[model samples]
Target: MQLQLQTLPKVLSVLVMEDRIDAASAIQFKERLRDLTQEGDQRVVLDLARVQFLDSSGLGAIVAVKKLLGPDRVLELSGLTPTVERVFRLTRMDTIFTIHLTHEAALSDVTGA
Candidate 1:
């Protein structure tokens, strides 16, 4: 559950420093995300470029984070691996989330820079 947190002007960027997000780490993932975002009102960008694998539990945890953020604060995902992207696509979760191809793109969209 190693995560790098970067606080930008308009966003809180959380870079997932793990290669896999599976059942074993799903709870930790959710807990860590919750802890990191508990005080922020800004948009959250979850950068998963290092994550090569994601299971259903992992996906569920992500969705839970979105819900936890409520309507005002958004949880955006970026830098998804091909396999992780496919899971989101197949599950149609892609439609529910604002996903960006890269971390820079997500920041650009939020910061309008």
Candidate 2:
């Protein structure tokens, strides 16, 4: 559950440094994200380039984070590996979130660049 948070003008980019998000780390993942995002109103971009695997629990945790963010702020995803992208697409979570091809793209979208 190693994650790095970078604060931008109107976005908080969380780079998921772990190679996998599974049942074992789901709870910790959710808690850490909650702690990191609690004080911000900025759009959240979860950079998952390094994440190669995501299980049901991990998916659930991500959805939970989106719900925690509420409707005002958005939870976007970027740099999904093919395997990770398949999970989101299969679960139809892709429609539930804005998926960017890269981390820079997510930031640019928020910054109007």
Candidate 3:
């Protein structure tokens, strides 16, 4: 999987290119997020519109990122595909992170809309 990083005014967005975020890509995904979060943006949003699948590893990666961000930082998720959304729901991660219907919404939420 390839993760594309985009920087917005107060948010750092990550666009995942792979449909499945499994063990194969989890490590790389975490590393990419680590590098991006180093930018120290107050908000971080992951764009999962293109990701059709997310496994336990993917969920773990997200959780790890959230922990790394600490309470002072904000972490949100956006554009979750149905399958991916189901995974989040099943894992009860939906309640743990802020989720938005679109990237714009995530940005707006981060900016305090």
Candidate 4:
């Protein structure tokens, strides 16, 4: 997966550009997220606009990232494609993390805009 990391004033956003996030790519994605979060950002947002498919491994990777972020950190999601959104909703992960309609919205929230 191609993971791009961007930083706002208070949030670090990761845009994943790939059709699928499966077992093969989940580890690398998780590492990227970990590295991004380790940069001392308070908020993290994963942008899944280009991801057309997500499996259990992908979901697990996200959950792992959330855990790594811990209670004090904010981990949000944005730009979820329909299929990936369905998985999140089905798994009730939508309630577990903040889900925004767009990256701009997520950034606005973190940046207090």
| The candidate that achieves the highest lDDT relative to the unseen native structure | 1
What is the lDDT of every predicted structure here? Answer: 0.93, 0.91, 0.82, 0.83
Positional deviation of 34 in candidate 3, in angstroms?
Answer: 0.6
> By how many angstroms RMSD does model 4 differ from the true structure?
1.8
Q: Which candidate is the best by TM-score?
A: 1
Minimum summed lDDT over a 10-residue window in model 1 is located at 104-113
Q: Output the better candidate (2/3) by lDDT.
A: 2
Each candidate structure's TM-score, on Cα atoms with residue i matched to residue i, is 0.96, 0.95, 0.89, 0.90
**Model 2 alpha-carbon drift over 4 Å, by segment:** 111-113
Tell me each candidate's RMSD, in Å, in order: 1.6, 1.6, 1.7, 1.8
Q: What ordering of candidates by TM-score runs from best to worst? A: 1, 2, 4, 3
Q: How far does residue 69 in candidate 4 sit from its true spot (Å)?
A: 1.1
Candidate 4 C-alpha error for residue 47, in Å: 0.7
Candidate 3, 1-113: lDDT as tens digits: 58888776777777878888888888888887787787565677888899887899989988998888888888888999898899989888999888999987887773542
Clash tally, candidates in order: 0, 0, 0, 0
Instruction: Report clash pairs, candidate 4.
Output: none
Question: What lDDT is obtained when candidate 2 is compared to the true structure?
Answer: 0.91
Model 2: per-residue lDDT, tens digit, 20-108? Answer: 99999999999999999999688899999999999999999999999998988889999999999999999999998889999988888
Model 3, position 27: C-alpha lDDT score: 84
Local lDDT at 36 for model 4:
69
